[model samples]
Target: MTSQNQTFERLCRTGTSLSVHSTYEIGGEARHLALPHTIEEVSTMLEGATSKGLDPFLFGMGSNTLFPDRPSDDMLFFSLKEHIEFKLLPGRLFVSAGTPMTLLALFGLYTGIPSFDFMFLLPGTLGAGVYMNAKYFSHQISDVLETAYVIDKEHPERGLISVPLSGCEYGYKKSVFMRKPWIVVGADLKLPVDPQLTPEQTDELFAKIKSKNLSTSVLPNYFRHYTNELNAAARAGYELRQELLDVITDRGGKKHFDYPSCGSVFKNNYTIGEPMGKLVDRIGLRGTVRGGAMISDHHGNIIQNRGGATAEDVTDLVKLVQEKVEAEFGFVPEPELVIV
Candidate 1:
């Protein structure tokens, strides 16, 4: 469908649609968008939407999508945010996929490199933290990958495909480019070149790593809904928003975020019995609600859309918080993706 005068010369009707509940602002409208830069213009718009068979829904920095209040037209969204680019070599570095894990955490504190200084408290993108093998305290990013590149649309003119970091089978947010669909376009990683800091000690180690990740400049926390098999309590200070609500109300119950959401809606079933985030906060499903979606009055597995919410009000509030937490703790909980 690339000819509506070539999609009005690459579309953008009044832009602003965003996802993952509109930056936790909450759901809908992305009808048709575009934001490519190269890789032959994203293989000529994915071969002009696979010769009109259309199946293009890529977005590197909507942070982590979820747009669906009523907007699909089948699926056509794009945003590799002008496919960034980076390099370094001799111990590896490459990096692209719209770079910005806070500019690889200030290029790992101006190069003294503490493995991308934990991406200055991650928010998203580095291709959604390597398609979800994302991590922080416990580290992972395949521990400094080593190669990736991708594109593989069954050989779209053999564009890009590197592969390698143990062939990306990483887990928890899995990979192999999220089970093969490819199109990452960068990563090499390795690290270690410091040559002993000094450019005034790498600008005083990137101003003490951006002042220890911006000394909590009053609530900006970023995202990370849990996946901590203990990095000694994220190196002791804990905080990934109170370790995702202390791994979900640590047992009995009690969670309730406010406003902001899209954080967690499912994907915490440590075998269901214990640590399913304290059994879905003892089966209360936290703040619970339906219409303008709720559940987060601070964090019962975060739903929040609050005003004029949609995506069927967060898909009927995740089927009424998984049917009242499977009728009070028998345990069921599911609903990690369904903006439609």
Candidate 2:
């Protein structure tokens, strides 16, 4: 056991506590964490973990996930931070899974493509976005996804097997990746050139996205120059208040992005005239607080970690919202977060 542990540590820098790395700014030490620069290192780590009876968990960007206060020692973590590669061909683009969705979106807009502008303010990497079939109001990642290179950890000898979009049974916030759960190395996306829109329509789409992101207080690329020098104090008062104001302006806003959170804590209503946010707002459960986490008084569907919040605290608060929503409106809400 010691020999294998040593080998795993040698393969990647193993850190003790990683709470600061989380978006929530919570959680305890990771038993082991690896940021492998190359795919070969990733393979070695996975193989070592398996042989040592440790469960391997692939992570990226740490955007859409929340870790436990202290995860099990048996769970080995590795992130593909260094695999972001892109190649532009005539009609398609080959990109590594680690590529930022924002980069792709910006590239699309510059190339006069449609539908990708929605990725302008979206967080997380392209891989996670595809796994979730990321949506932007009306557009979805699956709409342009041609093929993906996925590899089974148990059979790394096959390397990355390319699978077409048809192979992924994609739905609202779901994909076949959830079932088989392989590592996404690269993807091929067909460029948008069909049913081309007029220049006026393209301008309108970009404007619409910019307006939406502004109202939600989600940062846009244009604001990068201004938001770079933020210190500790600037983050709390000015930044947070601006976020709250955005929430106030849009009563049904998705503002988990406003705080350190894994986006929406609960899924929204599918066909109901009013969403889960509207229902929770009706019951006056907004601003509900447990520890450092609170149901945003500005938006109901969001539960924002106000700092120093724990996974247990978030879990308990979820139950609170579920009970209150069911008692008042006779409806139950499912969580979108995958609790570790």
Best by TM-score: 2
TM-score of 2: 0.78
Q: Output the number of the lDDT-best candidate.
A: 2
Tell me the TM-score of model 1.
0.33
- Please write out the lDDT profile of model 1 over residues 155-209, one tens digit for every residue: 5677887888788888765677767877786678887663454467645644443
Error of 2 at 166 (Å): 1.0
Q: How do the predictions measure up, each by TM-score?
A: 0.33, 0.78
Q: Model 2, range 295-324, lDDT digits (tens) per residue?
A: 887778777788778988888888998998
- After superposition, the stretches of candidate 2 with alpha carbons farther than 4 Å from their true spots are 1-8, 193-257
Candidate 1, backbone clash total: 11
Q: CA lDDT of 195 in candidate 1?
A: 40
